[model samples]
Target: MTVRTRLLDPAVARAMSAVSAAAKKGLGDPALAELVVIRASQLNHCAFCLDMHLGIARGHGVDERRLDLLAAWEEAEEVFDERERAALALTEAVTVLTDGFVPDDVYDRAAAHFDATRLAHLIGLIVAINNWNRVMVGRRIPPGGYTP
Candidate 1:
């Protein structure tokens, strides 16, 4: 499918960029943030986002094996730490909202690993990526075009 729009209006793009900046500043770990983005993209099945985030994650030094195993993070705990697992769980919850609500257990687990501010940032990142995924998927934005 062809792209519906080459870019969002400048104002809207700026707002989205601000949200991304906030996420980058708020989330201390670049690798963790990329993981959250990658997982959300995978769940949303957005090829553009998946391509972009996978490249970003690799730039942040996320291991190839970990990225490969992220789709099955539950069964590949050996590759993920507690914090990564918690973030992935949160990503899944946020991405698949129709499957069920974000469970209290998942939120609590992520909270246990992150402070209130960081948790808010993590949530923001999840929400932001989902928003991007919807836009890209809806517009059928082609993949492999993003540089970062």
Candidate 2:
């Protein structure tokens, strides 16, 4: 089915395209990026991103248990480790940017987990997903159409 709204507007699409190289740099595992994408999309209720990321995550060997419990990763002791946790925290902070600018504590925690360059890329990932979420949610992209 055709999406009700375009998934990528010109500006957002350009921004995403610009970040492609940086996102591919040696910041973190591609698998971890997929994990963060899935978790953030799940939290933001963005069907387009959730669909894309879940498939990527699975291709990278993410198990069903972890995927199923992603929304509750904090409460569940899944396979996600400290670095993943830090990425998740950053995702949550950026995705919900209105809750306030990403707090220093959040940035510091993520910085601790990742090097300067990796942390920058990590933040970029968060920003990218959050932008995607806003577009999808704002346009009210319908769900149940995304197949894993």
Candidate 3:
């Protein structure tokens, strides 16, 4: 793969992964955490992340239909629950950044569903995935060959 940087420093990469792990652990719901990361990866067009996380999501027992309909989750109300929708909406708001900041409505909606700690972890997860997305996309990393 073509790289913009020689490579991320090994320590930095490990630190980022650690942050992601912490966020996922705090968030508590393995499947929901996967969904949030997958949504962010989708928006960021991080094929490497998508390939890796999709497999992880399936392992967590997330339904194929949910994965298939994630891009259209807002419209697929029947597939995604309110909590999942809230998380997905927050993921989009944070990932796209076209609106400058995550809108209050989206944040509030997510807050309504998740407690303070979980909300923080959810945000942390989004940030971590977004960072990972940028690194992989910036480096033009190809999907597959990802290790768990």
The top-ranked prediction according to lDDT is 3
If the candidates were sorted by their TM-score against the true structure, best first, what order would they fall in?
3, 1, 2
lDDT of 1 by residue, 60-122 (tens): 899999999989999997999999999999989988976569999999999999999999999
Query: Highest TM-score among the candidates is held by which one?
Result: 3
lDDT of 2 at 4: 67
Whose TM-score is higher: candidate 1's or candidate 3's?
Answer: 3
Give RMSD (Å) of candidate 2 vs. truth. Answer: 3.1
TM-score of each: 0.94, 0.81, 0.96
Per-residue C-alpha lDDT of model 2 across residues 33-119, encoded as one tens digit per residue: 887778778878888778777887889888888888788878875567877888888888887776669898888888988999888
Better of 1 and 3 by lDDT: 3
Q: Residue by residue across 1-148, what tens digits does model 3's lDDT show?
A: 5656547799989999999999999999999999999999999999989999999999999999999999999999999999999999999999998879999999999999999999999999999999999999988888888777
Off by over 4 Å in 2: 1-4, 7-14, 24-26, 143-148
lDDT of each model, Cα atoms only? 0.89, 0.77, 0.94
Q: By lDDT, is 2 or 3 better?
A: 3
Better of 1 and 2 by TM-score: 1
Poorest lDDT segment (10 consecutive residues) of candidate 2: 19-28
